[model samples]
Each structure stands twice: as structure tokens, then as C-alpha cells.
Target: MPSSTSTSVSSFSHHFYTLLLLSVLLVAFFPGAFHYLSSLPFAYLSAASSPSSTHQPSSDQGPTTTATNTMSWFQKQFSLPPRSRGSYLVTDHVASAVPEIAQYKVGLLNLFVQHTSCALSLNENWDDDVRADMSDALDRIAPEAGPKGQELYRHSAEGADDMPAHIKSALIGASITIPIKDGKLATGTWQGIWYLEFRQVKHTRKVVATIQGEKA
Candidate 1:
């Protein structure tokens, strides 16, 4: 009976050792097995406890700031009417007339007349009738040709048109400065700028448009 009891206890001890050895052998051969088993739960716990990662823009990435820094100063010039006229119209097409000029985002525009008789003004360009009316009005104010100061007034040095041209220039003006925004003339919706050529004969009138702003 004592022998049988001892044998049973020894067998049980042997079985326990075998099970422990199998467990260690499995862990040693499949090294990543334990790691894989714990990975899912570990990942869940880590994600729950930690803050989420996200992307953010720096100062350089900001649109307005980038635009401001990228902007550059620029200038340009254009001619209008091609010839002297009694009535004329100015349009925004003038902006595109010079493709190179349009590349700059103009902030300030200065319009200059090369000739003394010619001048600049802002008016409606949409309607031809308006231009005709303006011409008629100017004609009424200063008639084309007639005697100056009765029959004999001294100063008539540079032809009849010369003095009259000077007078017309005085009545109208020479140069005008216009504010530009987003690379465009900032004239009112109904307003347009013009170069008034007072000469009767077709003259090469210049419209010097100077623009200052950012480059493309």
C-alpha cells in the first residue's frame, strides 16, 4: 500500500513538471506569441490614456501672412484714344491692354498727359451719348475758332488753337492719381477715367499710367 501511494505521488509530480516544461518550451520557440497576445490590449489601453495626434499649420502656412510676404511692388504705363478726339471713352479693357502690367497688383495709379493741350478726367465710359454730351458741353464752354478779345488782342503767338488748347487744358486738368485695389482701378461703378485731347487734328496723345504694387 505504501509503495502504491508513493508511486501515485511521484507520477503526479512528474506530470506537473512535464506541463511546466511544455509551457516554457512553447514560450521560447514562439518568442512573439506572448507579445502578440498582449499587443491588442496594450494598444487599447495606451490609446485610451494618451492624447490623439493631429496636424496644425505654422505661421508660414497661413494664407494671409503668406500673401503679404509674397507680395512685391511694381509699376506700368498705357496710351489711350491713339489719336485726338472730340469725344472719347475709357474702359477697364485698358487694364488688360498691357498684359505685363496686369501681372502687378496695382495699389496706386498715376495718369499723366505728355502734351500740354491734353488732360485727364474721370467720367462714364459705358455710354457714347454721355461722351457726346460732354464734348458738346466743352465746345459751349470754349468754342473751337473765333477772334480773341475783339479784333486786336496782343498774345496770339502759337496759332489760334494753341491758346485755346491751353485754356481747355486749364479748364480740364493735366494729371490724375487713382487708387487701385486687387490689381484694378478702384473707380466707382458708374465712373471712368479719361484723357481729354483738345486738338482738332489727329495727334499722338499719350496716357502715361504708372502703377505701384505687388508682382506676380
Candidate 2:
């Protein structure tokens, strides 16, 4: 009986040593795999305690609502009616041409004339006299003819108004920026956009309107 028990004990010890040797060989051959396996529990704990994970909505709370994109940009080109030399109130014309301006809640409206002989400005809206006076004032500033009724400039290739038109356009600028609020232009009660045409003959003009803001 004693001999049989000793044989069984020796067999169990040999099997245990074989298993330990195999495990050691596997670890030596695949150190990176063993390391990754050993670090899995620690990585999981760190991720669970991270700020991003803390902010995540609970699964029991159902699907989360996505946020709306606030920043938006819109641009469109439109044509203005033909006009002779003058400063005309074009607020209505711009609004009519770019109806997309009404989609913004708070933003900026930029109106850019595509012509060099015309300018865009902000000025008085009410009286027709203001427009007339502005035209006369610009004519005095940059006249088509000299004091003796002679050609004053050399850049009259287009017409007598060519050089003077360019000068006036430069002085007044070809673009105007206005604030928009509640999907409407926020100009002052007396303020309006002005389109200054420097040509003697009537000519149609093109304008590019750009809007940047949050959508309503």
C-alpha cells in the first residue's frame, strides 16, 4: 500500500512541473502579449474614471440629442437695375435681391458691388435731396471735365466719365457691411444703403451679398 501511494504522488508532482515549464516558455516567447493581458484591468479602470466617460449619458437615459451647428455662411450674387449718375437708396434692392438674409438670427451682412465705376455706402434714407447733394458733392470732388471744360484726365478710354468714375468709386468704396439682428438688417432708423453710380449713362450693376451668422 505504501509503495502505491508514493508512485501516485510522484506522478502528480511531474505533471505540475511540466505545466509550470510550459507557462514560463510561453511568457518568454510572447512578453508583449502577456504584458497587454496583465494591464487590461488597469486600462479599463482608468477609462471608466476619465472625464469623457463621466460626461457620457447613461444608457438607461436613452439616446442623446445631437447639437445643432451654430456657425453658417451664405453667399449669393444678384443684379441691380440700371441707373444714371447718382446716389440711390438701395436697401430695399439688396433685401429683395438676397432674400436669404432673413434666415439668420444674429450676423453680418456684406454687400459688394462687382463694378469699379460704382460704390456702396451707408447714408441718409429719407429725403431725395440727400441723394442729389451726394452726387453733386462727388462730382465736385472728381469732375469729368477740367475748369476750362477740357478733358481733365488721361484715362478717358471708356468715356469722359471713366477716370472720374474710378476716382469716385475709390473714395466711396465698393462694399458695405451692416449688422443683422433677428433675421433683419439692424441699420439705424434714418440709415440706408446707397449705390453710387458714377457713369453718365444708365448701366446695370452686379452685387454679391454674403451673410455670416447663426441660423434662426
- Candidate 2 residue lDDT tens string, 66-132: 6766789999889888999988998998888888888999999999999999999999999999999
List the candidates' TM-scores in order.
0.57, 0.71
**How accurate locally is residue 196 in candidate 1, as Cα lDDT from 0 to 100?**
73
Clash count in backbone of candidate 2:
0
Candidate with best TM-score: 2
Query: For model 2, which pairs clash?
Result: none
Worst 10 residues of 1 by lDDT: 63-72
Q: Candidate 2: minimum summed lDDT over ten consecutive residues — where? A: 49-58
Q: Report model 1's TM-score to 2 decimal places.
A: 0.57
Candidate 1 residue lDDT tens string, 1-216: 579889999999999999999878978999888688769898889998885554446679874332343545444555665655565665554566544455656566677777787678888868878877876787667665555544232445765556666777888888877776665677888888776777767786766666666654
Most accurate candidate by lDDT: 2
lDDT, model 1: 0.68
